[model samples]
Target: MTETAPATATPGTPTDPGTGSIAGPSVAYQNWIDRQSRNRRQVQVGRALILIAFLALWEVAPRAGLVNPMLTSYPSAVWEGFLELLAQGNLGLHIGVTLLEVMISFAVAMILGTVVAICLWLSPMLEKILDPFLVVGNALPKIALVPIFYIWLGPQGSIYAVAIAVALFITILMLYTGFSQTDPNKIKLARTLGAGKRQILTKVVLPGNVHTFMATLKANVGLSLVGVIVGEFQASKAGLGYLIVYGSQIFRMDMVMAAIVILSLMSVAIYLAVQKAETWLIR
Candidate 1:
């Protein structure tokens, strides 16, 4: 007898028997995936084009005498200024110092802020008592309090205090709001199943607020950087903020612009790190 082929398993999708081709949901889903991929690529290409155009204009405008290079330094001058700092070893030292302070303050702010938020969630009375203070702390111009922190913690240590100050209240308010806004029906359901307060929080409230936690962390990361820079402005002698202040004072516009560019890069890097962590946590 002629050999017969073994039967192959067919996928669940409806198939065109004549062509042996998927002709149902699988085809639609594949098309949707392809469409999304094309859209993402287009977005990336558009963003790159816009950025290149902006940088090209910025670099050209100053050198062509269109914009005052002295007041607004060109990209080449900013690059040269970076090289100057690099040759002097100031670039890495100052960056490391600022990074250290930012990391420390960020950790402290997130921890303490989250704990306080949890406490407020657990006790409505405590939340009401502290609500005004939280709002006031968030609203008050943080720079004005730098002096008090400086005096209390001295010049070098003040950066940590200021960093914590800038991030703490905002984190607390955002997280507490997230916690309070957690679906009450879930909490009630958990309790009806004999879950205790702590169980409800762990199982219902905390899990429900992961996105909020990530959002608040993103906000605090920037705030912590701002605080560190401000603290450097008021106290530190060798950080990027100090460099900016010193450069501006002596009219070394290139150095000031370089410092600013470096700060922007640092903030972007930190924010990217947060985004990466968010993606991992979400996964």
Candidate 2:
């Protein structure tokens, strides 16, 4: 029998079925990628369909005389109003003022709320003593306080008042719950490792409750905007809320709708930013 040439296999060398080259990606991985692409496309299609349907109805109802265009402006009118505002630069000024108020109030509320939460967390007695006060404060309608804030802090006083009203209860309840629910085993472990109360709180409690804090922050963003707008409604010469009041008083529904759209966009942006920050912090 003729001796067959011995098949030689190189050591530490991967062999391919045909070209002897390593594969790029597995079939499973490619399938997963395809699935993700498909899902994203589906989502895009759904959003486009919804937007088209809404615009179609918005345009048709008014044009068909089913709805009075003078009283309720269509999407095109709102778009035109937005373009006019952009040309005049007044829109930018209003947006800036509203943003400033929201940011300042939110910052103050965050700092004060965090400090109070920490204090309450550190002392069970203080939390218990303050619980009733917190309950009552949260229960009270914050809008009713706009006038009081205007009187106390002047017309602009609503900024601080609204921030406090919106954020106080959220921060307190979230942080208190987080503190109370601290993992006992982790606390014990830290103590065993010679960690002091301060160390435990700074290292363990704070980190552990980060998710809760983020959740509270997300909720407070909308609340903060509401407070600012409501405050503006009560007393303000500038801001989107002022724009709405001005537009309504003049029967410029287009302007009112435009301001509303701006408010909605701003709120969404703030919320999305908070979410991104939370994700980054957690990661």
Candidate 3:
């Protein structure tokens, strides 16, 4: 037997050496990738254009007397507020605190969610018993629990707990939904081949839920941030949420807007990290 040298072909088009016909690379996949790339670039450009237009309108509106700067701050005022924060040297400290809380919450929620999901998947009876409780828990207004958490965990840790609570239900729901919806046919096929529960879970169910986990992470990222901000709003002395609260009290709309912009950027950063992870995973 001889191993033939590997054949080289253009992306999307491949040739089989033995049959001298086209084969290997998938044309549809290549085209889809091309289209997706173009769409992504277009979306980014559109977002930039919209942002520019908004800032321009904001700047002109206040200066042209169409709107009040004190009520709706312009980009320049926001920038000035940011600079003041930077000069005060607590800007990074506050951001770092918030990011830390969000990351911790996101991590804890993801781990616990995945574990709980797997446990539920392993026991149908247990899942049935707890499904109602889960539905009720998920349905509960999380923000309403902030005061309870503050009293329970104290100011130092309540923020973290609040963040976790905000995201935990979503994570569990997404993961459990993924695990439950895995094709029954696939499980049965594996079982018919003498595969046990553990084997089926590892080889069939788990592998198929990668995308679900990625989606859950993306959602968890946003939820975690919201939780953190809410926690900070009522708990933390140092964070963007605290800054917004403080600014609002002082009637410094510019500072409040700056803090909000930072929060938005943080959310985007975490979500983009999830997207990057997904890209690496799919590749």
Best by TM-score: 1
Q: Residues 173-221, candidate 3: write the lDDT tens digits.
A: 8999999999999999999999998898899999999999999999898
Can you give the lDDT of residue 39 in candidate 2? 78
* Alpha carbon lDDT at 80, candidate 3: 96
Q: How many angstroms is residue 117 displaced in model 1 relative to the true structure, after the best TM-score fit? A: 0.4
- Candidate 3 stretches greater than 4 Å from native: 1-41
Model 2 segments beyond 4 Å from truth? 1-24
| Root-mean-square deviation per candidate | 7.3, 8.5, 6.3
The better candidate by lDDT, 2 or 3, is: 3
* Candidate 1 lDDT by residue in tens digits, 62-141: 88999988888878888899899999976899999999999999999999999999999999999999899999999998
Clash numbers, per candidate:
0, 0, 0
lDDT for model 1, on a 0 to 1 scale? 0.90
Candidate 3 lDDT (Cα, whole model)? 0.89
- Name the top lDDT candidate: 1
Q: Rate the local accuracy (lDDT) of all candidates.
A: 0.90, 0.85, 0.89
